[model samples]
Target: MNQPDHEFPDESRTIRPHAGESIEDTRNWPGLALVAVGLVLLALTLTAAGYGFAGWAVIAGALCGVCLLGGIGIVVAEHRRVKAR
Candidate 1:
């Protein structure tokens, strides 16, 4: 006997995208806080250190910290949004 071809897929994977309303209630406090902290630390470190290799290292670290924090916040928000759907 010949079986009819299905238009929709018979999925077994549970990681399929959600077919529901999108939850767009994202917060900015976390990323803002990180940026603020990073700026403050960079200012203090640069002011006290004056000019040297150590100062450059400190500045790099501050920038990296800010970027890492921002990335983390974004990841968390996306995770929440996906879970909500």
Candidate 2:
């Protein structure tokens, strides 16, 4: 018994990387922005709670510090991801 001849295309193509390859930076910016905004709102709330403008200033200061920390974290994480790639 003779088997029927079947033709198949060659499949040995080499995949090449693009010239503009860059690492993806996925450091939740919106989330960080939300946290920063929340901090401002919280400070406003505190001020309205009769703690006076001074209390709001304090809250604002704290929020600023938190935002700084969060930004640093994001930068570090992005750096690590880029280095890993």
Candidate 3:
């Protein structure tokens, strides 16, 4: 069988950077933390609703909103930073 066109080759390759080439930093801890908090709050919200605890669910849902907004804010700030560069 032929491999799909979208598949990358399995051959090993070596990459060499030219002079003055610097590796870029690719860490996004704040956004990752916000996303993780949002996911945990999502689970809490679901569990609370399943247990018929409307109050807990509401609180968790509100926290979920905050986490989501924080994630969005991080993304927007990062985008602006990259655009400015």
Give the count of colliding residue pairs in each prediction. 0, 0, 0
lDDT of 2: 0.56
Error of 2 at 19 (Å): 16
What digit string (tens of lDDT, one per residue) describes model 3 on residues 1-85?
Answer: 9975552322124243333222132434576678789999999999999999999999999999899889768755765564455
| lDDT (Cα atoms) of all candidates against the true structure | 0.59, 0.56, 0.71
In TM-score terms, candidate 3 sits at 0.64
Q: For model 1, give the 10-residue run with minimal summed lDDT.
A: 17-26
Model 3: which ten-residue window has the lowest total lDDT? 16-25
Model 3, residue 47: what's the lDDT? 100
lDDT of 1 by residue, 1-85 (tens): 9997664433334555444212233454455556676666667666656655686667666775776578568646766665566
lDDT of 2 at 67: 71
Error of 2 at 9 (Å): 35
Candidate 3 wrong stretches, greater than 4 Å:
1-27
What residue pairs clash in candidate 2, if any at all? none
- 35-78, model 2: which lDDT tens digit per residue? 66767766676665555667666766677667767765765565
Q: Best candidate per lDDT, number?
A: 3
Off by over 4 Å in 1: 1-52
